[model samples]
Target: MTAGRPAPAGPVWDRPEPPSRAALSPLSRERIVAAAIALADADGLGAVSLRKVGAALDAGPMRLYGYLSTKDELLDLMADAVHGEIELPLDAGWRETLRALATGIRAAALRHPWFTELAGGRPNIGPHALGVMEAALAALDRSGRFADIDEMMSARGTVTAYVIGAVRSEIAEQQVERASGVSEAEWRTATGPYLKRMLATGRYPTLARFVREGADRSAEEWFTAGLETVLDGLGQ
Candidate 1:
């Protein structure tokens, strides 16, 4: 060292190095969103909160703020993560593509029932969500069925509306069954006598006829039938 220069600051050799601290699991947006999703899956959307998600991660609620600004933002992330579950077929026709997309979305919604609540109300701009939109639009554009982009978008919107509405209804029924601890079949059987009594009054002839004549179809059958009807209309 130069005589005029102060010796460079050096570590204290006599002192033991600071006790090694155990590494905490690293926090990330992915981990935070995943934790939030798990809470939503186990319970309903209402069960998920920053505090609870933080607790799941062994972090404080404030620690989540670094990755998420608000609960709505967290919800957006969760919705997109579920959207990632949808599989897009690359070589199918437009109608088939749309069908597959709708089916995939319905499956995802059933898996994460809260997803139906978040869907269709706001724009989902996350990459996975945007990929879904892109796949639909690209299929329509490639089909050459639309007069213009406006018509194409209208078709897409219509399908989206139908899927969201149908899935919401399905989820609502599932929730009702869960809450009542009664299956739909059991509920119908239990209420059949009362329904017959009410229909016997002759005020609901159409409903009575439908009740007697309507085919017993699974929820999947109903959903697929509705989806096909929508697609048929679009194909025209």
Candidate 2:
């Protein structure tokens, strides 16, 4: 060997190699979304971010970019993943199937409160979300009960809209209770004076009567009653 110029850095292989990244958690779109969903479920949707999700996997935020281009895409993926969870029966009739679908969707929303919060932020045309829609549509269309196509489609929309609206309200209350550590009924009781003052104004006679006579409705009772009302409207 000529032994010149510090031996030419000893054939380059003598340089120390990077400590193998083998210990790093492998990441994928599904894994990233799952991490985000887990964070959201444990905390709330506001808590999910690329940095937080990556940290959950013990990786860096840049690793998530390959899988999710933007935060909205991750949210969409999380919503659709929940959509895939709604269990459907193999051969239930239209009314029964739609009812079950609505019920399952509500259960899923309650299971993941952030789901109801983000679902309406974007149109969920992802595969699983579309699969849910197609399943409900196929079931409804097969019944041939409506006078026209518009009616049938509207029926699907009615059920979907009702469930989204109802579950969103239910979950918002649950989250508020969690955050404030005060039950909703307790909050209402705390605000009873304002309600009575408003009632004294005599602006809402119907509301006043309901307040005086109506039994306290549980979340399920409210949701089920609203769902049945929507279903009854669709049956016409």
For model 2 the TM-score comes to 0.81
lDDT of 2: 0.80
Model 2, runs deviating above 4 Å: 1-23, 197-203
Query: Per-candidate TM vs. native?
Result: 0.86, 0.81
Model 1 accuracy (lDDT, Cα):
0.85
CA shift of 15, model 1, Å: 42
List, residue by residue over 1-236, the lDDT tens digit for candidate 2.
22241332321222433333455598766688888889998988899988899999999987665555567767877888999899875567788889999999999998898887766666677777788778788787788887777877788888988899989888878767988999877998999999999998999999999999998888899898888888888787
